[model samples]
Target: MSQSPTLEEELERARDLSVSDLADAIESIGFECTRCGACCTGHGPEADREPHTATVFPDEVRELQAATADHAGDETGDAGDETDGAGRDEDAPADASTEWRDVARPMPYGLTDGDDGPEGETFEWALQTDACGDCVFYEETETDGETTGACSVHADRPLICETYPFSVALDGTSQPMGEAVDSVTLPARGDADEAGDAAETVRAHECEGLGRDISRADAEELAAALKERAVRELTEAVGVRDTYEPARPGPGEVVVHDSEGAKRPDGTSVDD
Candidate 1:
């Protein structure tokens, strides 16, 4: 059997990818977010009611924490009495102590959902989810009697979120990780049928906006981000492999493995 490519090999492949070529592929298969929130919520008809899980880097988690704290501070700036006319403190200060748990949780991939909670060692972090299994940062706004879904932390969202529905076919890196509920297969590259080779390296997952017309500038921008994501993912995989160490946790306890090393679900160092 063929052995899987090493992380370093994958990283090299990622670096060698041509951003211009990726842009051409993206332009060939266009996309534009319809803001349907299907990607952020579990309840969409095409979602299969599964929680949205996007890999987030440790630095991205910290960035999200900072963003949330700043937003809380803005909402609580000195404006007047905290109480409303009804004498209720409806405008009380928002919790500014945004912890790691507030922004992300251990990705559930290698964990087991026990009676107490998820138990086992997982890799990386995922954005927090609401009780409804929707992204915690996902919100809906009603304007002109039309409701549109939006992300509260869109500016600080993780790379996976930024490059949704688009993933590079590279080893040691799986963006849009799970089996896509729906996807668009691009045309064969060169003479794929004659050569028995796979199609293009760019894969487009489920999105209502797929097949729409995309401007050259937008396609190029997306391609750049996609390339960055591919490189980062492979780099992170190498880090994880180099730093990985076995851990033992009691029942109901969960450990997470990331590029930084092992950590508890709360983002605390495992040694702590």
Candidate 2:
């Protein structure tokens, strides 16, 4: 197996690439999403919108916060809450909760291909659609004089968007499963026209690296490496683990101790 780069390394590589370069890299990989809406529709049975999984940029977070704030006016500013006219941030912690942390949470359950059912169905963590199942960011556009609707958040779209034509399942291990379509997969539209021709060209470029089938072993290895990197980066980014205080056991709360040593919080330190 080939060596997988650590998350830090990947981040560094990302940082090094210019915007144009980044776009070029994605193109070279054979991903040419035509905004056909398939990715946003049920067509993506195992789609996720998590920032980590979707390559969310720092600016996207800031923009989202700003846009949501502007739209709400006087509602509430929070994950799903609307902003209120009072200018107060609705996402602020109330008198009861612990201090709020700024880091994004781990990617939630659904958003990917898996065998789990009902109780395990995962959903992406982003602006949800009303009844349409479309992304809140999905947009339709028209030429200059006409108002064109489009995902305002497209530029900084999630990591999942970048790694498309391939599915990475982050269960116990990171595994790359073969997507239903590769470059070889013919576009549903007949390939007679220029658009179809271009689509075919894009497909050929993307499938070059992927070995026809998704290898479970490769997926697990990649997942494990990413998990390690994520854990380390998260700990550093949040600095929460370093400051976390283990809960004090209540009375009669049996504390498991090893044969080598034991200690209690009541001013006692014992070593075997």
Candidate 3:
């Protein structure tokens, strides 16, 4: 006699599930990461597909900048100034000019160029892409002239990255990122008819690792990581929101913030 639960309502109930229960649910199906790196490389020009995205939060942006700055300093003699007189190693990456923020731009989905709004710009950032349009952090390693994909900054990668091809489906139909394209369709749950439009779809991240055998232990591990990512994302989002000063005029309004600091919309630096 009662109505069905919505996706958000289902996720709320999912949040209260125990680790064992969550793992069991996912494992009952199965999953395993084979390190194919399809999600990382995305579709390329050779494949005639557009670049895929991994969303990032504001704090993660700061973290990336800090890491890049630290790396840059080490590459230059700057770290030497802070420590002993040892200059940078000769074998460092040559690009000292690549700053952290430069690695990411506004994702094209919900933004136009310079569309930071009349107020202040939100501080969102994302992983940068390379010349071929793959993630900049993604690298191709050649062993025996065979190529393999890897993340250059794996440890520092965002939560969206860590939990790719997997999410808590609201309809109690927890499954791989998706079942289309590179994914195989999930076995229809018993309540498929009832699910209707309420069922959440997967990202179908085009991973080769789906449908593999996943143990209870493996599912538990995934559950723990997903939980951690959820908490961290919310915390960072709140901190970022609390810190934003909306009254400050952004690019479209008056002055704008740029690499050289605040500037007029006409491109003259405020310092000038």
Residues 1-272 of candidate 1: C-alpha lDDT, one tens digit per residue: 55666778667667766677888888888888889887887654544567878788999999998888767655555445464443334555444368999889999888998888889998889989987888899999998998899999998888888888889887776757444443334455454476454443788887888888989999888888888898999899889989999999789999999999999988999977
TM-score of 2: 0.34
Global lDDT of model 1: 0.80
Q: What are the TM-scores, per candidate, against the unseen true structure?
A: 0.84, 0.34, 0.59
The residue pairs in collision within model 3 are 177-202, 177-203, 177-204, 178-204
Best by lDDT: 1
lDDT of 3 by residue, 60-178 (tens): 75577666656655656764444333444555554544454455644444333556554334334446667666777787777897778787667777667777666544443323323
Across 1-272, the per-residue lDDT of candidate 2 in tens digits comes to 44554444433432332333223323333333445544443223346432222222233434555554444433434444543445445566443221111212212343233344222212112333423555555667767756443554555444444344443221111222223443332232342363322221112223334443334444333334333433333323333223333333343321212111222211122232
RMSD, every candidate, angstroms:
5.7, 15.6, 8.2
How does each model score on lDDT?
0.80, 0.34, 0.54
Instruction: Identify the runs in model 2 with alpha carbons over 4 angstroms from their true place.
Output: 1-5, 16-33, 44-62, 71-106, 110-129, 139-149, 152-272
Which candidate gets the maximum TM-score versus the true structure?
1
Whole-model lDDT, model 2:
0.34
State how far residue 123 of model 1 sits from its true place (Å): 1.0
Query: Which consecutive 10 residues in model 3 have the weakest lDDT in total?
Result: 176-185
lDDT of 3 at 121: 40
